[model samples]
Target: FVHYIAKEMTALPVGARVRIEGLVKAKEHNAKRGTVSRASAPEGRVGVKLDDGGAVLAVRPENLERIDDGRGGTRGKGGEGSNQAGESSSLPPPKKKPSSLEPKQRTLKRDNAILREFDGSPDPNLLVLYYHFRDNAFDCFNSSEYHAQMIRYYESGLSVRLVVPRKIGNNDYFLVGLRHSREDKNALCEVAFNCKRSFSGISMLVKQRCFVCHRAGAPHCSGGCRCACYCPGGCEERGRTDHGRLCRLVRESDVTVEEECMQLL
Candidate 1:
């Protein structure tokens, strides 16, 4: 944001002790110039001490150019004695910092959209497609047909169902499914995680009430699989089919989420 003024540039190297300029009759007038007192001058010039005068004088790079190096050579713009024989090497480039704000903001926007479109469906498949579309904007979901398909799925409410996998650190989590009726072929609503519960093994604590009925009670785990939790009173029975499929996947997964984050396509 600060613009450096090129007109104020000075050739003298600041902080170097140097002899005063001029004074042809002075004893050190022909001697090597003293070190420059400072790099910058008050009036947009460089500060240097004369060999004989020893007083600071504001001068431009051109003024110092007249100073002989005693070997019939002149001082360079950078400074006197900068290079032994006018040979110089460029400095190393500066380092750049990588930024993560752009991607994070994009993810935040996508999450907000998901929460808005969510209709209490436990399906994770639709979410996968949604994220896929977002990450790969050039992919299939952006098309009119795909958009319609996604809209339809979002509007399906409790009828549509899909399984999703989430990796948190080294642990993997699947959304808990719930069924409310014996005739229900799949779970409709996802069980919410209890944030207050103690975190054990990348644990996602189940909501105190049933994921389906919202009943107030302790939850029951289905088939010993940690992925599905329900009310033993009856919600567990309704989710048996849908939750069974998820449980089977979790059982068969040879790699734990703790090992690596997987893209569940």
Candidate 2:
């Protein structure tokens, strides 16, 4: 992995006119022309300030192509002396990426624990909590932070009514009245401000059921997303098409395995 980066990277000189090329993580940066702002940054990458804006981005030299006279010309020499026009561009590409070495993995154990804990058996009141916050699973799943804070508010046990609204992002937080009181207000405000995810959502109730038939505590999980469950019989097959939609979205989600484990409980 280190060899691939070392072989491809050619440091760009400060003030060198270059065009951002190659697959930048943020798609918008590709093909954007920029001048080398700093010859080097903290990391072993060149820093370029975009021609359109003042934001300096640290990019690997391999992702940049040199512009000869401010106009698109030969491929960048990466400041390695000089090269013929298209000399660097002519080489066959190698199939290597930082992400390739560490592939994504599912968090089944945590998912199972969450589903079996809070979202316990189809209680009439709890409903499908997972569905409510499926879109922002990461945010709402951090309720643990809120729990600890609330306990500390009274410095002992305090009687308080609960309002677990399905919708967040609105200013309708239940603690607004006490958002400004000293010692009292700040604690509430701090809890609200620090924990924005109210997070937000996607937790499994204690009693999990197959998304297909709602069979209590379905034994099987959809292998693709590992989020939904299935009954022991042909339930997995029966819900293939319907579940596929959500499955693909979950698989594509950029959430890390660590985040998933934290969301448990």
Candidate 3:
């Protein structure tokens, strides 16, 4: 019984509001209400970011129970305090419909990115290419996982659809200087390839360069597509041949790229 309790971790989705239940070692936080801030984790533990203090707790599922959320929505858990800790509730079964943030919606985007994969055709340097992946851990975003996804992007070479969010570790972290140059991939023998990983996404992309004339740092971008670069007069005119066709297609794709963080000013 003790061993069973030791390894049991409930599969609560992230953002599921919970009330801390039974705990021995850390009894100070008992009865506190918090949301299941992290539903996905490497340690198979739950991360509850408290509403009162805002400190995230790594507790077992047995210690957290889904609550009424107080916002009309059960957060997909159940109604009015749902089940007791570790005991299935008699409350109406939790909603089955997936939320927008769920993996289902994101799978389509990832699929489209794969189908429309492009490696900048004539010259890889000029045009912009967005890297994408399905699953991501918090540390992996900046650490080894970042590189792995970059390599995956290089191999797949998708340019149409943008990447979507995955589970980040239990923190509000930021990854800068994310270039598409190189990053670490999953190691067979747990390899060590620690080099700076370059990132280029919708939020922060490399400087635009003239796609047609092969010139660095171009002034104009194809209005509709917004990926291809062009110089002022002659260069823009020169690249028109290739950019013309791509411009129409990208506009037709209608894929909107969103920035990760909002501008303060």
Index of the highest-TM-score prediction: 3
Candidate 2 lDDT, 102-207, residue by residue in tens: 3222111113343344343343233233322235342222223332333343343232322221112111112211111122222111121111211111222212
Please give, for residues 1-265, the per-residue lDDT of candidate 3 as tens digits: 0111111134366666667754657778987988776775556668888888789888766455555545322333442345544344666755777543322111111122221222123343313332333333101122123324433443443333332111112211111221122222211110000001112222212223455565644554546455455677887776676556555644555354533321110
Model 1 residue runs over 4 Å out of place are 1-211, 215-220, 255-265
Give the worst 10-residue stretch by lDDT in candidate 2.
171-180
Clashes of 1: 20
Candidate order (TM-score): 3, 2, 1
lDDT of each: 0.34, 0.40, 0.40
**How close to the true structure is residue 115 of candidate 3, measured as C-alpha lDDT?**
14
Off by over 4 Å in 3: 1-52, 55-207, 213-217, 220-222, 257-265
| Cα lDDT of model 1 by residue, 206-245, tens digit | 2233444544343535565454456885777776655655
After superposition on all C-alphas, the RMSD of every candidate to the true structure, in Å, is 26.1, 20.1, 15.4
Q: How good is model 2 by TM-score?
A: 0.26
